[model samples]
Each structure stands twice: as C-alpha cells, then as structure tokens.
Target chain A: MADRNEILGAAQGAFNADPAASMAAVAEAAGISRATLHRHFDSREALLVELGTRSLDQWAGRLDEVDAEALAASGDAPAIRAALETLVLGYVDDADGFGFALTDHVILANADLEERTQVLADREAVLFAAAQRVGVLRPDLPPRWFGHAIYGLLVSGREAVRIGDVARRDVGRLVLSSLLTGIAQPQNQDSTP
Target chain B: MADRNEILGAAQGAFNADPAASMAAVAEAAGISRATLHRHFDSREALLVELGTRSLDQWAGRLDEVDAEALAASGDAPAIRAALETLVLGYVDDADGFGFALTDHVILANADLEERTQVLADREAVLFAAAQRVGVLRPDLPPRWFGHAIYGLLVSGREAVRIGDVARRDVGRLVLSSLLTGIAQPQNQDSTP
Candidate 1:
C-alpha cells in the first residue's frame, strides 16, 4: 500500500513510453516482482482502471483549481478566457504524463470510467455553455463537441512535441490558439513576411 | 497468400475495436487459427507493420486522387481550401477504418514505417506551405504542425461519431471547420439565438 503511488507512477511512465508494454515489463519498471504487482492489481485491466481513475481525479483537481463552478457561472468572457488558457497549459502536462490512461481502449471501455468521464464532460459542458454565452467560445457547435475537440487537440499537440514538430514550450499556446481561433488566417491579417 | 488481405482487414478491425487484444483474439477475429496467423506474419509486431504500411498506401492513393502536387504548386487559396476539405472528408473514413494502424504504438515505433510516415508528412508540408502562401492557412505556425492538427482532428471526429457525440455526416464538416477557423466564435458573427 505504501509503495502503491510509486508503482502507479512508474507503471504510467512505462505505458506512456510503450503502450504495448506487458505486465512483466510493468512489474520490472515498477521495481517489483510479478507477484507483488499482481498483489496490487489482479490483472492488467485492474491496473489500467486504477490509472484511468487517477488521471480523471487529477483532471478534476485541475478544474477545481480554476474554480470551474464559478467560471461556469461567471458570464465574464475575459476571465473565462484566461482560465481556459490556464487549463490548457495545465492539461499539456497531464497529456504528457497521463497519455495512456486518457486514451487506452481498456480505460475507455470500462463502464465505470466512462460514467465518470461523462460527469467530467458534463461539468465542461456548463463551462463551455458559459463561454459561448459570453462570446468566449464559438456558438455554432454543441458544447459537447468543444470537449471532444480539446481532447483531440491536446493529444495532437503532445504528438507534435514528441515528433519534434513543435517545441514543448510552444504547444500550450499552439493548442489554445488553435482551439480559440483555429489555423486559418484572418482576412484583415496581412500575410507579408 | 490469397487470404492475406482478408486477414489484415480482420486484424485491423479487431485492433481498432480493442487495442489490447491478444494475438489469439486477433486470430479469432480473422477467422483463422493462431498457427495460421503466426505463419502469415510470424509475430504481432509484423502484422501491425503490414497494416500500417497498407494504411499509408491507402493514404497515398487518396492524396494522389486529389492531385496533391498540382494543388501544392497551384498557390490558389480557394482551390487549396477545397482540396483540404476533400482530404479531411476522405481521412475521416480512413480514421474510422484504419485507426489502430494510424496510432498503434508498435507501428509508430517501427523504423521503416516512421520513415514512410515522414515522407507522407513532407508531402503534406508542401501543400500546407502553398496554402499559407495563398493566405488559406495561417502563416504563424510551421506547415508540419498543420499535419499534426489534422491527424488529431480526424481521430477526434471519428471518436465523436463512434461515441454518438457527433453524427457521421457532420464529422467531416466539423473537423474541417475546427481545423480552418477553430471553435471560437467569430468576433463579427452574431451570437443572437
């Protein structure tokens, strides 16, 4: 129990580095015997579920730090935009550290996690609706689609960083700008170098 | 040898349906014995590489259909935007079909496939550069980041369709719009409901 958090952290690192990592590999990475790993997590599925839950918890914690409830009700576009930027920056690190947990098929398929994720999505819906109301986010699409788009962008941003296409320091800004305005140049903005 | 394509198709479906699926599961999905699967690919990694290669071939074929080179050299903003829309729509189907091949860790780690992927990416860079030059795409980021963003958007669009968040018919437009203009409400666009 005492080493559980350490084990999960090591396991997450191993999984992110190689999604195909096996239980034996995870045990080795966690500096434990297979017996001990099994003792902590009866199966790979169990471990994945725990990891997924932890990732969600961390995500929820981040949202709380931004006072998501207050932001959802604020109707203050500038404040909401600033909070959104902060959230995107914070999520970049989460995307890097908890990539597998957030995207794993097993975690996605798990009913409990799916329900919990939906709850988070619902919370985000409130925030997005508030943003839309305040003109911070686009109103043409459903609020839920915003959540889906961010998920894709974050993963994409992380991949860009990993592949050396975008600098790590620049990814958060790239993702936020892409989310808020997109990649198309405005008509008024001159293209001159 | 004759059943090879059929086997790969089955394996692709199985993997997309469950990334954690075992070789036995893949063989079962392919309607073949484990021994036959091994005889065909020798290992799971080999099968993934073959799938990834086939997906790249299909992607290349799609790009050819659009006359990518001509578009890259055309420097026509409207034409480039239309071509980009067509490409995004085509890729949504590919994302739905060849998803695992596109994002599988084994395929991503394979040296040969990475080289092929880079080649495809370079081709995309040319198109993006032309778009930027023509003021179709924003000139603020590298052309390669555009490719990364689209990859993320396509995957996200597919997931939206799969999870019933966005309809199949709407995913293409949603992805294109998100990529081009982003999700933020246009400043001049009326938000009145």
Candidate 2:
C-alpha cells in the first residue's frame, strides 16, 4: 500500500510531463519493478482511473477551501492573488489531474466530475463578477473568458514546470502577473498614475 | 501536387480538431479516397513531416511580416495589436501545424524548426523590450516571458476554437485582449488614474 501511493505520485508526474508516457517509464519513475507495477494495475487506464478517483476527491477539497465569495467581496488584488495562488497550488500538487480536464478523458465524462467542474466554474464567475464590480478585475474581460484563461494557464504552467521552461517556484508569479497586469504597460503607469 | 496540398490542409484541419483522428476521418475531411491520402503520404509521420516543413516556411514568413522593430519604434498599442493579430491569423489558418509545437513531435525535434523558433523568439523579445521601454508594455514583465504567454495563447486559442469553446473569429480578440489588457480592469478607468 505504501508503494501504491508512491507509484501513483510518480505516475501523476510522469503522465503530467507527457501524456504518451509509457508503463515502463512510470515504473522507472516509481523506482519499482515492472512486474510490481503490473501486480498493482493492469494498464495505464487502470492507473489513471485510480488517480482520477483521488483527483476528484482532492479537487473537491481544494475548491471548498477557495472561499471565492469572501475573496471576491474583499475585491483587493492581493485577495484575488491568494485565490489564484490556491488555483496554482492545485496544479503544483497534481497537474496530471488538471491535464485530464484539458483532454477528452473519461474522468471528465464522470457525472460527479462534471458537476464539480461546473460548480468550480460557477464560483469563479461569481468571484470575477464581484471583483470587476469593485474594479480590480478588468472590465472588458468576460467572466467566463477570464475563467478559461486562468484554466489555460493552470494547465500550461504545469507543462512549463515539467519541461524546465519555468521553475516550480516561479509558476505563481508568472501566471498571476500575466493574468492581472498583462504584458502591455498601462498608459497611466508609464508616465504617472 | 495541388491535390497533395489540399490533402495536407484537410489533414491539418482534422488533426487540429482531434489529434487522435483516424485515417478514414482525414480522408473524409480531404474529400478524397483513403487511397489518395495513402498515395500521397505513407504514414501520419510522413504527412506531419511535410506539414512541418511547410509550417516552418509559413511561420518564418509570418514572423517576417510582424516588423517587430517597426512596431516597437512606433510605440503604439494598436501597432502591437496588429502584430498580435498577424500571429492569431496564422493559427486560424493552420492550427494543426502550430499544435505540433505544443506537443512533443518530430517536427519540434527538427533542427530547422529549432533554429526558426529561436529566431522568432529573439525577434519577439526585441519587440517586447522596446515596447516596455517605451511604456507601451508592462514594465515589470520580462520580455521573453511575455512572448511565451502570447505564443501559448496562439496555440491554445486554436484548440479552443476547434473544440467549439470559442468562435473562429473570436480567436484574434481573445488572444489580443488577454495579452494586452489582461483580465484586470485598468486602475485609471476603474476609479482614478
């Protein structure tokens, strides 16, 4: 059982790095024999199914901790940053789980997963709307669109970390800065605010 | 030869829509016999190789048209917007070619591609630096990081379009708005400058 959890973590990391990662690679990553891995799981999908089960549980807990409404009500950039950080942390923990959402995986097709995802999306919408009303979120950005962009970065930032494009610690800053401040300098800030 | 080009376009479209798309599906997309597709390219890799070659040529031409130096010197947001639009246009035309960049493929491993990608990145950095120095881009951003986000959006926006998450026409606006203004409302407009 101890080895099982370890193998799952290693598989999550390997699959997150490359969807096409092989069973041999997962076994190698887990520091276990291929036969031992075979004893635990029949195929990649079986491993993924188990991982998916854990993923849904973990994701649900993370979403519960978000306190999105409170953050939105605060309407401070730092508060939203905290919320975004929470989102990023989820990626750091189990990016492979998030990757499943991006793909046509059976995990996404799960009824429970679908409802949870919608719940999360709906919460994000409420938060963004509140923040926008308070003037922290950009007015031009549609709430749904903002949600997707955040979702995109959440998935991509993991790939960046896996490929050594960005350091693990830098993921938060990179995503938040890009999401909120954007790359274009504000006219007000360039000269005088 | 013309039929070959047409088949390639169809394959790109099909693959962009679903990377796991089958040969039969691709043939239907091309409006040709399965034999025709097979006659032109022995395998998906062979087709991808030819597409990769064409992709490199097309990408190089698009980057050249960006006139990064000119846009930077102008220090105009709209000019930068135009350059960004040029990028989005290419993705709309051949998303599968760009998708090759996102995934690990022989196309990415090719030396010519490696060099071309470097060239494009270098040009983009130069443009971004000038824009930041001129106060058109966010000063806090590292120019290269900004370029990657823009590039990421270019590839992902196409995926979004193919998945029907966004309309084909919305790709340009979504990428530009997200890159330029971000999701946060400008402080100047929100309350006081």
Candidate 3:
C-alpha cells in the first residue's frame, strides 16, 4: 500500500512537470524499476486513471483556499475576479499534470471524475449567485450558464498559453476582462464620471 | 494524384467524424486498402499535417466570407461578433478533426505547420482592428491578445460539448458574450441616473 502511494505521488509529480513525459521516465523518476511500474500500473491508461484521481483530489483541496465569505462581503466584481485569478494561476502553475488529467478525464468520460469536477461548477455557481445578488452579472443569464462561460474561458486561456498566443501570466486578466464588460464599450454610461 | 486526394479527403472526413478513428478505418472508408493508406500518409503524423493544412484552408475560406466593409459601416461590435460566431461554429462542427490536429500539432511542434498557422493570426488581426475602430474592444488589450482569447474560447467550447456540460449549439453565444462583456457586471454611472 505504501509503495502504491509512493508510486502514485511520483507519477503525479512527473505529470505535473511534463504531460508528455514517457512512462519509463516516470518510473525512473519515481525510483521504481520499470518492471515494478508496470506491475503497479499495468498500462498507461491505468496509470493515467490513478493519476487523475490524485489530481482531482488536489484540485478540490485548492478550492478551499478561495474565501467565499470574503468574496460575498466585498465588492462582487473584484471578488469574483480575484477568485478566477486565483483559480487560473493555480492551474497554470500545475498545468502539466492538471492539463493531462483534464485531457484524460475528457477522453475517458468517467462518471466519478465528472462528479468530482462538479466541485468547480458548484464553486462557480456560488460566485455567480454572489455576483447576481450584487446586480453585476446579468440576471437573465442563468447561474449554470455563467458557470459554463467561466469554465469555457479558463479552458480557452490555458490553450492560449499552450499555443504561445498569450503569455501564461496575462491569461487570467484577459479572460476576466472579456467576461465582465464584453467587447462593446458602454454606450451611454460613464461609470467613472 | 486523384487517388491520393480521395484518400486524404476521406481521412480528413473520418478524423472530423471521430478523432479516435484509426487510419485503417479511414482507408476502409475511402474504399482503399490499408497498404495504400500507409503509402500515402507514411504515418498518422503525416496524415495529421495534411489535415492541418486542409483545416487552415477551410478556416481561411470562412474568414473570407466576413464582410469587412459592411462590418466597418455597422459598428465594429456587431460585425466582429457575427464573424466570430461564424468562425467558431465552423470549428465546432469539425471538432473531432480539429481537436486531433491541435493535439498532434502541440505534441509534434512542427515549425512548418506553425508558420502556416500564422495566416490565422493575420486574419484575426483584421477582425480585431475592426473592433477597435468601433470602440467596443478595450484599446489597452492588444489585438493579438483578443485573437488568442477568441481562439481559446472556441477550443474550450468544443471540449465543453464533448464533455456534455454545455450544449454544442450554445458555444458561439457563450464565447461571444464572454468576449464582449467580462464576468463582472457594469457599475452604476456617476454622472447620470
């Protein structure tokens, strides 16, 4: 059991470092013989499933860091923006593993994994609710739809970084701004004035 | 040459239909032998490169459909949004093939392919310039940044549809809304009621 835990942890680190790293490399990095790695994982798909579970656990834990109360108490726009920034930056830093996990989760369509990801969706709903209470988010758009939009932007931001079209640091801000004000300038209103 | 074109076209079609479909399946669909497919593509990698080129061609053709003069006349916001919707929907319909192409492109990082994709960047620039002229887009953000955001949203929307979280039909609207107005709601005007 301890060996399995060690192997899983090592695999997670390697995935976090490089999503495309070879299995043999992971075994080596984990300080396990290739044969042992195979014995434990049996196949790349098996290893990925195990690794994805661990990554999901980590993602869930990170959500705890988002202070929902503070966000609720403070300005809705800034707070939601901060929350998004935190989430995107956290994912960016651990993109190697997170990216791989997300890809595998999508490909596998594992129900349990999908259920776990709902944690994010739930968090987003909470944020949207808060935003709506403040009259920042359009009431016409459902919270679920807003959550979907947020997820879409995050996914898009990550891809932009991968394609070298946008720097990793700027992804959060760019995505945030695009969601808030949209492309059209406020025609009649001058909030600052 | 005609046979080769037929095989390539078939492969592209199969890829668009299902990303995981094997090259052998594509060959079969084309009514050709696996050996003939192998002779034409050499490998999956080669087949993907050809597909990527074709996808780029298709994307360019879609951009050409955008009425730049009309867009410039009717306020940049509406024109650019309409054009983006058209472009994103085109990719959504061909999600499987484009997703495979994107994954392979990232894994291989082919400089030649990268060079070809620049045409997309140039096309996006024209759209961004129009948005700027109409004063809808934030002048602070670079046109390239806007392009990346749009591209990212399109990719994410495809992934979202694949995961069954968001409907495929609504992806264009979600992406468009996020691009125009960010997550935050607009604040009250200081100068007017």
Candidate 4:
C-alpha cells in the first residue's frame, strides 16, 4: 500500500512537469510496469483527480505555516508583503505542479473545488481586514475585490513569467507595489481627510 | 481566388468559435466541400496562420480608424479610453482566435508573427506617452510598465470572464478603474508625490 502511494506521488510529479506525459512514460519514470500503473489508476481522469486533491492539500499546508501571530505583530502591509513574496517564490519553485493544478482546475469546471479555494480566500480576507485596520489597504475597495485582484495578479504574473516577458523578481515587485500604492497620478493623490 | 479567400475567412470564424472543430466540420460550416478546404490549406496550422495574419490586419485597420484629428480634439485620456475600448472589444469578441494565434505563435516561435504584436505595442506606447503628457498617469511608473499592466489586465480579465467569476462588463470596468485609479489606499495615494 505504501509503495502504491509512493508511485502515485511520483506519477503526480511527472504529470505536473509535463501535462502531455504519457502514462507509459510515467510508469517508466516510476520504475513500475504499465500493468501496475493501470491497477493503481483506472483512468487518466482518476489519476488527475487524486493529484489535484493532493496538490490542494499541500497548498493548504503551506497556508498553515503562515504565522498569524508574527504577521499581526509586524503590521498588515508588511505581513501581506511577506505573504505575497512567499506565494510568488513558492509558485516559481514548484511551477510545474502549481501550473498543473491551475490548468486542471480550469479544465475540470468543478464548482465544488471552490470549497478548497474558500480556505485560501478566507485567509486572504483576513489579511485584507488586517491591512484595512492598519490603514494600508484602501478602506473603500471591498475586501472581496482586493482578494480577487490579488488572485488576478497571480494568474497574470504566472503567464507573464511563462512567456519570458517579465522576470520573476520584477513580477513580485510590480504586484507588491500595485497592491500597496496604486497607479493614479500624483496630483490626484489627495486624501479626503 | 476571391472565393478561396472567402472560404478561408469562414474557416477562421468557425475555428475561432470552436478550437476542436475538425476540418470537415469547418468545411461544412463554411459551406465548402472538404476537397475545397484541402485545396485552400493543406493543414490546420497553415489555415491558422492565414487566419492569424488576417486578424492582425484587422487589428491594424482598427487602429488606423482611431481618427487622429478627433483624438487630438478630445484630448489624450478620452481618446485613449476610446481606442482601448475598441481594441479590448475586438479581442474579447474573438478571444478564441487570438488565443489560437498566441498558442501557435509560441509553438512555432515565429518571429514574424510576433512582430505583428509590436504594432499594437507601439500604439500602446503612444497612448502611454499621451497620458504622461496630460499628467493622468503616474510619472514614476514607466510607460512600458503601464502598457504591460494594461495588457496583463486584458488577459486576466478575459480569463476571469472565462471562469465566470467576473461579468464581462465588470471586467472592463475593473481594468479601466485599476488603470486610472489603481489599488492603493487614498491616504497613501499621493505619498509618492
């Protein structure tokens, strides 16, 4: 049973690296026979679903590592900045896995997956609320909008990196700056207060 | 020759509507025989390249239609706003075609095909320069960065619409608002100034 689980993990890694990786190739990489692979996963879809669930679990675990107490002590903008940096670096390091998860999530059209996403979204909302308390994030922009904006940047930044148009470091800086300062003209920057 | 061009246009429309549409399916939709389709283009890639070239031409034509006199009379921001709306609408309406072109361009690594992108980029640079002159866009944010931001928003907004998370109208509004106002809190809005 443990051996089968290990094989599945290896297969998942191979699939993440190359979506077009054939089952036979994965079996070869795992040093398992085609028969064994078939026995483990009845079909491609079944294998993908298992991989997706595992990937989501890993992402959730990373979120758990974020120290809420430490973040609270540092203040919102800085904490959010740190979190965003962690996200970009993590995604860059495990791009293939993350990309596979993103592409699969899109292809599956599984509204149910939002249950998993909600965990991340809820964490983001908490972060945004903290930023608002610190008067760093715009109080006027709804937290939901802020959360969505962050997600949008992540998706776009990933694509930019993939296309080689933007460097990874630049993406991080751009996202952080845009989220904190905005792009409005300096003259229009006056506050109501 | 004219008839062949018409058939090619029809094929482009059909393929844009459905990427998985077979050659036979495209022929039926184009009101042409399978023989005629094969006679015009030997394969899917050839047909797509022709269509992509046409799409690029159509895009250039739209930019030409951007009435320079009217733009100058209306002033920069409004003119840019009009031009951008036109471009964004065109891309949105034929996202599949543009998407196909994007993917094909990447696969073939066709420099000539990518050169077409520069035409649009040049136009964007003009708009950014105009915004700078009018003091609407922040001087600190490089024009290239501003252009890339708008491009990123367009791509992100399209995906958001695809995912059904944001309405099409709202996507446009959000892109425009984010470009014009940015995401920064009001108190920090002019802190850079």
What DockQ does every candidate get? Answer: 0.62, 0.41, 0.38, 0.25
TM-score, every prediction: 0.91, 0.78, 0.72, 0.61
Query: lDDT per model, in order?
Result: 0.85, 0.67, 0.65, 0.60
Q: Is candidate 2 or candidate 3 better by DockQ?
A: 2
Per-residue error for B193 in candidate 3, Å, reads 18
Evaluate model 1 with DockQ and give the value: 0.62
Chain A TM-scores, candidates in order: 0.94, 0.71, 0.68, 0.67
Give the per-prediction TM-score of chain B: 0.94, 0.74, 0.74, 0.67
Better of 2 and 3 by TM-score: 2
**Fnat per model, in the order given?**
0.72, 0.45, 0.50, 0.37
lDDT, residue A45, model 4? 63
Residues B1-193 of candidate 1: C-alpha lDDT, one tens digit per residue = 3398899888988998887678999999988999999999999888988988888998898789888899989777778888988888888878888876656778888999999899999888899898888888888888889998998887788777767899878888899889888888787876634
Better-scoring candidate (DockQ), 1 or 2 = 1
- For model 1, what is the error of residue A112's alpha carbon versus the real structure, in angstroms, after optimal superposition? 1.9
Candidate 3: tens digits of C-alpha lDDT, residues B55-144: 777767766677544564566465566666676566555554566555442323566777767767776676776666666556667677
For candidate 2 chain A, which ten residues in a row score worst on lDDT?
A100-109
- Flag the better candidate by lDDT, 2 or 4: 2
TM-score of chain B as predicted in candidate 4 = 0.67
